[model samples]
Target: MLFLTRRRKVQREGIDYEQIDKEWDWDHFLILQAFVGATVFFLFPSLLHGLPLWDLRGLMVAMVVHVGVSEPLFYWAHRLFHKGYLFEHYHSLHHSSKVLQCFTAGFATPLEHLGMCGVMAAPILGATLMGFGSLGLVYGYILFFDFMRCMGHCNVEVFSSRLFESLPFLRYIVYTPSYHSLHHMEQDSNFCLFMPLFDALWGTLNNKSWQLQKDVSSGKNDQVPDFVFLAHVVDVSFSAHSPFLFRSYSSMPYTFKLILLPLWPCIFIVMLVMWAWSKTFLVSFYKIRGLLHQTWVVPRYGFQYFLPFAKDGINDQIELAILRADKMGIKVLSLAALNKNEALNGGGTLFVNKHPNLKVRVVHGNTLTAAVILNEIPANVKEVFMTGATSKLGRAIALYLCRKKIRVMMLTLSTERFLKIQREAAPEHQEYLVQVTKYQAAQNCKTWIVGKWLTPREQRWAPPGTHFHQFVVPPILSFRRDCTYGRLAAMRLPKDVQGLSVCEYTLDRGVVHACHAGGVVHSLEGWTHHEVGAIDVDRIDVVWRAALKNGLKPV
Candidate 1:
């Protein structure tokens, strides 16, 4: 719920999400300890004795205690915390985080947390004193309290004003995220815990709370992104690492999780449902130098790409996403992962050809990709072995290296394709391009560029000390431990990237796939041409220089 709400933030003001990510440790521990202590105290008979497991009377009593005692106490205590000494020494710690995430509810100084713990205990103690306490009531009240705190601090408006309009008294009974957000921003109003009735009675409610809630819930503040990266899932398990599912997990490079293994069947079922009913949806968003950039998922998996029958369906999804971006006046839409597969859509050529008048630039982003891979090869090296030699990236690498007077042993069974690429090179350098059918033909070459996956037996052909550079998806297995393998071509994003809390695939923080960065450069340069179809080999150096000028460090 928190993740869904955050995607539709009520307050669009900029906040350092990275800073907030770093500030969660101590407060999280403190809150966990408090909850555990409360549970232990209520369960074992330390102060208030453990009662029956379930009782209707205990449930009713818990509500009364909360409304009559807990709510008022918290309201007054919250207001007090905003005043002179309390505000400066303790409460200000919580208020320091101007942006409210769900965890923000528990992010407070120990003293403020202590007071909150006390307020929570009031309801359980009161129920016990009234001879109606039960184990169910204690657990129920505590869980409900925690839920309300998280909801208020979640920073997104989930409640509709229509609910309040239908039940007018509910406004005084329950406070919304917008209402709590105003208290954080304004600092002197809307000082309620879970109910606005206390604030109403004390004449401290913010005047804009209701209107702001209505406006946000109705989506009046949503902004159109300037650039969108059209991406797809890599596999079933890794799909759980999406930013909307788990912030901490998505913030780091992904690895197979043993814990997630048990959930594979469930996740696979979700994939089926998505294949059946899902449309393209926003996965994450961030800003770079005031430009709104978003990542949208195509709702298909990597394995699906290899299934010939699923090809058209996948392209249909990508086409829909492109048209949608164009309709929204988006400037650029870059295809990522299999969304730009050459065999699938000819590296986004189908859409460009079908809709030639598209105002939105459809970019395959392989230009920078070719540049990154090409630059990774040592400039002094004279000869290199290339696999998947006839593919888009392979052809470009071969031609570029041939022009540099470097020998490129192109591995392919097709003589026709090799000759076509060979002819594209300058006549003076055409001799540098050599065609080889067997992997053993390049056994003497130390520089191996792999575009296709190599099996253990096939990998044995590479002599010792050979370095394998790759642009392959699900990068080839490191079968030969003696050789060093390069990761998929990638680059680090600029230092000023904002609200980027999720990592791109297996890349580290602040780093993205080279193609992803390519799209970013295209948008930043305001290039009006569509970077679709075949990669312009001539523009490889241009994109590389532009990336460097824009602060994109090669990784």
Candidate 2:
């Protein structure tokens, strides 16, 4: 069945189908190891004991023990391997293969393999300890474990929606191929090997597991609907310094190396071609389907064209994103990070003026960003140290916080702009502690609202215990022991959002900044005008509710 399905190239849920070729060798080696190890273990252990054949009753007990005892042991052991340096050193080897096949089922380091083997054998081991062990039951259990492992890793959806729809309760207990595939995608979820009892009880189930299962089981294949596209460019020139890029490059075969080694020069040539073409090339990046929504997203720049040094091309990239959105009948096109800066004169006013005929509404998403940031701030946070205080986002946050009677230590590079804002403050804010400074003068303040991109040096210099409300992309703070950081994101979307799936620009908690969330909100609301600069604070509720309706927190 597996071979027949593979030959037909049947649809695989949540897999990069192309990655199968890349992972083939590693997965093949592990399959060989598992068979060899199982053979040796089976032969050697039985040679000492001779055969203790099972009756029907003994076989039934062993089966129950495997599910009741062996599964829980494996679950905890699997979760233990996920902890800190253990995952980095040992278990991460298995995760290196993002695309799973039956061959990839047992692809773990020797240590992990041994741990899993020990866990899986606990049922037979217990039966022996209790003096009723049978060789037939032992062999049966071993086959069962290997079969289930292979089934979980197979790029096939075996469980149909009718089974789940008719017996909805089974959805909680059953761990299908799609369920385990979700674990491969989201490393922190769906930890149980045979059943999802532990995962559901412990709250480690992947958010998308049920949905992916339902979508695939219901016969929803890879075809994308006519949907709005969205994403930011990963300027390969700038990402050349990224460790992730270097690691990925080094792991590739020599043939891949030959191609990727000259990526920069190739990108330059591609950019010139694109420039000559003088039209946006809409490249379908990826497609996603949820129970309620399906979308096809595209990014708007060649690697070389979006490099920071290539400032002349930034506006063209912006025009391409909007134009492509319009071309695709995208209701709303949200500008991300640098794209937002280059468009609308950093406030969205310029884009509205330059492209009045555009059907797609352009949004900066500042209002929802301010709202999400402020929502995460604790009520006891009476003081906040803010950077980028002169920018539109910074001023809006300052005004909002000051209205709440919070002392704000505003920091900007310019003292002139600082004093001007203070002078222009509301009459009641005249007596408030809205101090202005040109340096990192605020200390002992636990709350920080960083609205500007900071250098690595400045990021390191930020005070300890400062809970940062970070708005900058490629976040400034490291995962520090002393600091707590809240990345700006859209969270807990409302159900009314028809099948929205935000791949990037979100924290695990589902929080997105108002900027991107604002675009999603506009798309949901059918609003097609420019929502630039400072968004009114009152609009936060509208954005928040939109996110909730799309599935953030249930109504």
Candidate 3:
């Protein structure tokens, strides 16, 4: 029934029909239960002994009496369920979906549902006992109650300010969609559903509810994307394989390599089949709620399928997520680590070429990451060591250091790339050197920033006092027998930032990686419409502001 309303839907920010479809599975159960309950109560009612139908005046009185009594009863009952054990066992079920829908209002455990039913029925039952109730009043209350509940549960705000503007006092008596939405989001406020009267009286009203109600009512986020998805894939083979397997696979006996080569096609076919069949749909929905109110939906593709054998699968998956994000109206999207590498190098080029209509601007987010890393580097340190000199991030950092006239040691496997970077450097800064070496060569440096490609074992080589910075997911692992190493991490911005919009992830502990953080920064700045690829040093302050706002203390 609610799905029909979605056809000519209220325009709100972050309404993903795909996400709605995924959640609709649970609505069937709720609908079926409601149908059974209605059938039992009305069609074959054993409880309504004699239908003592009442007139219009009696119905009006019953409505007034119902609100007066039900408010306090429902308030206390709701509060009690939120207490310790009851919350963990029952109330949490209702709180699970922070992004509510009309059908979701009735989506609760049988016990909780029964409790609500009893609370609503109490006033009507009392009126019946006093011989003042009618079948008309009972049915009227049921329909009206269901309508109000749906309005409250619907994520879209339904109330206009005109009525409230005329009568400001109505806010105390009438709760809006945002009133109930805040309860789902904060869990501690807006406890009274019938009216804010009880919640206000008991000091349980959320401080931000009124402001949020005003914001949503004005359609603040109507133009912006409802959610932004950060898409990436894991290296399953790298995770699953042993170090020996990697070495052996790279340089095995010529005959053995020949034997394995024949199976390559078979492996590819199997991987393709698995990827085709796999459900590359919605992975998770994140409800970000601190500084701003919004939702981020992450839809995953089976990108890790052809791992160790081939990397072609990654491109397909990135494309899949990109198309999906576009459909979800995610104006700004960032590719995570390997996904970025694949997309920018070739797949990304092909995608933009093929789909000119796609409005989503893809960003690698390397600009802010480099800025965060540079800002974090100690001023006292004399030299900086960096691996993956050929990577976009490495190149940006290397160029930045060259311009600053600081000593930097850029390490890479390609001798040609090293020479090209060194040759391009200013003649005055010969100290900005490039070398073809591994992690071992950077031992003497006090500052170490490595790419994501470095293994856990290789990372442990950083000297004792060295402040190691890694801009990678799963972060740099520490295998030190004794926990005594100086490690640095990206930091979150203060709650109050001067001269900058406070845009940040509500969760992730303010600890978001540079790539995803970049997109978030762009979104906050209202620059989702523009394309951002390699950020320049002069304009790195955008990333700085975002990092400061979203960054947490390094772990």
Top candidate by TM-score = 1
Tell me the tens digit of each residue's lDDT in model 1 across 246-303: 6677877898889888889999999999999877766667888899888888899999
Better of 1 and 3 by TM-score: 1
C-alpha root-mean-square deviation, candidate 3: 14.4
What local lDDT score does residue 225 receive in model 3, on the 0 to 100 scale? 38
Estimate every model's Cα lDDT from 0 to 1: 0.85, 0.61, 0.59
Q: What would the TM-score be for candidate 2 when compared with the true structure?
A: 0.50
| Candidate 3 residue pairs in clash (backbone atoms < 3 Å) | 14-226, 54-134, 343-348, 491-551, 491-552, 492-551, 492-552, 493-548, 493-549
Best-to-worst order by lDDT is: 1, 2, 3
Q: Candidate 3, overall lDDT?
A: 0.59
- Provide backbone clash counts, one per model: 0, 28, 9
Error of 1 at 141 (Å): 2.2
Q: TM-score for all predictions?
A: 0.92, 0.50, 0.51
How many backbone collisions does model 1 have?
A: 0
